[model samples]
Target: MKILIVEDEPELLKVMSVFLEREQYVVERATDYASGLSKIANYTYDCILLDVMLPGGSGISLLRALRDMGKLDSVIVVSAKDAVEDKVQGLELGADDYLAKPFHLSELLARIKTVIRRNNQHREQALEFKNVKLFPEDRKLLVNELEVCLNRKEYDLFYYFMIRPGKLVPKTALAEAVWGDSADQADSLDFIYSQIKNLRKKLKDSHAEIDFQAVYGIGYKLM
Candidate 1:
């Protein structure tokens, strides 16, 4: 999963980034309100860790802006402010959870997982599309109850497609969703084609009922 950490304290920011990265999350950081706003406006994330007191503005304002833009990304307000009003304001403005400073990294991880689960209430432990089933917790895929092994990238790509079955997914969006911010550095989308090819072969070999159809020069749609 990918997360955005909006914090001004350099040490805390670095510590959170390292801890979350070690836990296998793709971590992105912003030092202040402006940078955080820019990142949220341009990209999507599974979760956002927001610090209330920021250089340019309050994290409350950023949360308000996010809601104004109709972005429902799960937000956890991580701040030193433990005041009741602060917490109330954050919750009222759409933050999914709040964590005060001096908390354990393990606790933060637990809260992150909880908020993400709440945000994705529509998706259960196992995601099903046609005859294929994806166990996200185990990173396992099965067709007709038979396991179909896939590498990390292949699984990520296939899962991305599975969630949006029958919908056309643009190449750039797919790359960003699976590869995170690093996808911006790619010169072309040839890598997506290669990944799709491998996933297609795997699905076909497994006799899966669904398939991905290329959209000529645009993208692909899972059908």
Candidate 2:
């Protein structure tokens, strides 16, 4: 998962980045309001950790701007101002959660997980697609009460397909999501095809009827 942190305090920002990265999340940081807003405008994050006091402007203004632009679902206000009204105002503006300045990194991580859980409508800790059950948190895939062992890319490919069931997914899209940012630099998408082939064979061997349909001109659809 990807997260954006908007904080001005260098030490706190660094600590948070390290903590979140340790938890296996992609972390991006912005020191002030302008940079934060620019990042929000450009990238999609699972959640945002926004500091109220910024170098260029107030976090409340940033929250307001996010709301104005329909990004209310992606922000959580983190600030030193712990007034009752400040909390209330931030909540009313659609911040998913609020954490005071002095907080445990664990607590912040938990909040991010909670926000992501709340946003995911069709997924639980155990992701269910048709008859297949994928425990993303546990990296386990089960079909018809049977456990199926999968390699990292195989698991990721399965999870991605479950996340967007019934929709055709392109080979490049799968590569970019499952692989690192360097997926764009790959010489061929043959590796993706190979992964798909292995994943499908495993599912079929398990008696799972999940279909990875090739769309000919487009991509594969998880049916």
Number of the predicted model whose TM-score against the real structure is largest:
1
Best of the candidates, lDDT: 1
Candidate 2 per-residue lDDT over residues 1-223, each given as its tens digit = 6678889999998999998877766677889889878877655567889888899898888889888887645678887755667678889999988888699888888898888778766556787777899986777989997899997678877777898889988877776666644465798888888988998899889989787999875679898
Worst 10 residues of 1 by lDDT: 78-87
* Candidate lDDT values, in order: 0.88, 0.80
Q: Report the C-alpha displacement of residue 186, candidate 1, in angstroms.
A: 2.7
Candidate 2 whole-model C-alpha lDDT, 0 to 1: 0.80
lDDT tens digits by residue: candidate 1, 53-119: 9999999999999999999999998777456777899999999999988899999999998998789
Candidate 2, run of 10 with poorest lDDT: 175-184
Candidate 2: segments with Cα more than 4 A from true spot: 123-125, 150-157, 170-198, 201-205, 214-219
List candidate 1 stretches off by more than 4 Å.
none
RMSD of each: 1.8, 3.3
Residue 64 deviation, candidate 1, in Å? 0.5
